[model samples]
Target chain A: SQKIEQNSEALNIQEGKTATLTCNYTNYSPAYLQWYRQDPGRGPVFLLLIRENEKEKRKERLKVTFDTTLKQSLFHITASQPADSATYLCAIHNTGRRALTFGSGTRLQVQP
Target chain B: GAGVSQSPSNKVTEKGKDVELRCDPISGHTALYWYRQSLGQGLEFLIYFQGNSAPDKSGLPSDRFSAERTGGSVSTLTIQRTQQEDSAVYLCASSLAGQDRTSWYEQFFGPGTRLTVL
Candidate 1:
């Protein structure tokens, strides 16, 4: 069976520090890898997307790196603030499927 | 400029009863999807609809779960004989390109309808 794993433990960081999250998957080759931000009681919002051929992607303060050889992706938030604190999820487009498969997500807490 | 919207922000039902959740996708969106998120769990794919083509029901967990998208816009996920395990946040998402795998369209999710089956 295919699996997408993320650190379930909440990451606590001081304000202005960089927050890094990891997503690992096995048994599937995804064409596109995406990151999303989800808040308590709210649905996830789209973030960054990196294609298999691409090694990295960036948007504003967010950056994502996709290493298909390692079957892992990293999400980084630079100059993080308290408002940036939320659960981050990683999704992948299964080769032939139109829907995305998402990881459980990692929660980040930024303290001021 | 409206995003995806789902009705009945919250629903509570008794076991063995049936419930229907609605999703209204963004105007001009040809793709729609249903997903379930359990407590402390990731989103589970439920169903997918693109254009006027036959929907892909491969993700539905059980026969008790069924969904329909009419006119390629609105969708309804119906759960019959609901069990306690059915309690979760049901999320609906939409994208512009349904069959364009090359495009890799990002999904826009709705606020979600939390279902509590007792």
Candidate 2:
């Protein structure tokens, strides 16, 4: 069965540092992968979408790297702040599936 | 400028009772989806409505769960005889469909309805 896994433990980092989150999957080849930021009691907001062919994508302070060979993706928040503290989710859009399959998500906590 | 909206931000119901959750997708969004998220769990796909097509009900967990989209805009998900396991946050999302491949995969989600079955 296809599965998506993220770090279940919350990650705590000091402000002004970089935070890296990992997403590993097995048993599926997705056409594209997306990242979303979800705060407590709110819906997820789209952050970035990286296709299998693309190795890396960046938007301002956020960067995502997709390595289909390793069946993994890395999400990075550079110069993190307390505001960046939230649960970041990884979602994959499998071929022929209209809905995305999401990972359990990794929670990041940035302390000032 | 409005995003996807779901009614009843929070619902508490007794076990074995029925509850209805409503979702209003953004204007012109042809694809709508419903998902459930239990505590500390990933989002579970429930149902999908795309234009006039017959909805994909494959993700529904049981026969007691049913959903309908009226006039390709508003949607309702009904869970009959709810059990304690039915407690979760129900999320709704919508996206553009057809022609634009990029836009099709980017979904805009609404603040979920937190349902508690006691």
Candidate 3:
């Protein structure tokens, strides 16, 4: 069976420090991967999407690296703030299906 | 400019009873999906609908779970003889691409319907 996993432990960091999250998968080749932010009671919001063809992607303060050979993706938030705190989920599009399989997610807390 | 929407923000039902959860996709989004999230867990894909074609019900956990999308717009997920294990937050998502198109877009999710089975 296909599986996706993220670090189960909650991460706490001081404000202005970098926060990194990891996602690993096995038993499937994903055409693309997506990252999302979820709050306590709300649905997940899309963050970034990296295709298999791309090794890395970035936004203003966010960066994602994909190593298909390793079946792992690293998500980094630079200059993190209190508002950037949330649970981050990693989703991969199954090569044979349209549905996405998501990891359990890692929670990050930025303290001021 | 509206996003996906699901009705009954929260639902509490007795075991063995039936419940219907509704979802209204965005105006022009032709792809709709249903997912469930348990306590402190990742979202589980339940079903997907594209246009008016046959839905992909592969992800439904059991026969007690069924869903329908009518007129390519509204969708209803029906659970019969619900069990306590069925309690979770049901999420609905939509994207702009129709089934005919090969290119896909990011899915916009709704607030979700929190179902509590007692």
Which candidate achieves the best DockQ against the true structure? 1
The CA lDDT of each predicted structure is 0.92, 0.94, 0.91
Please write out the lDDT profile of model 3 over residues A45-104, one tens digit for every residue: 999999888999999999999999999999999999999999999999977677778899
Is 1 or 3 the stronger prediction by DockQ? 1
Candidate 2: tens digits of C-alpha lDDT, residues B4-110: 99989999999999999999999999999999999988889998889745458788999999998888899999999999999999999999986969899999999
Off by over 4 Å in 3: B98-103
Residue ranges of candidate 1 with Cα displaced over 4 Å = B98-104
Residue B81 error, candidate 1, Å: 1.2
TM-score, candidate number 2: 0.98
lDDT of 1 by residue, B27-92 (tens): 988888899999999999988888656457788999999888889888999999999999999999
List the candidates ranked by lDDT, beginning with the highest.
2, 1, 3
Tens-digit lDDT track for model 3 on B32-111? 88999999999999998997554577889999999998999999999999999999999998887756333464888999
Write out the backbone clash pairs for model 3: none
Cand. 3 Cα-lDDT: 0.91
Give the total clashing residue pairs for model 3. Answer: 0
Docking class of 2: high
List residue ranges in candidate 2 displaced over 4 A. Answer: none
Tell me the deviation in Å of residue B70 in model 1.
Answer: 0.9
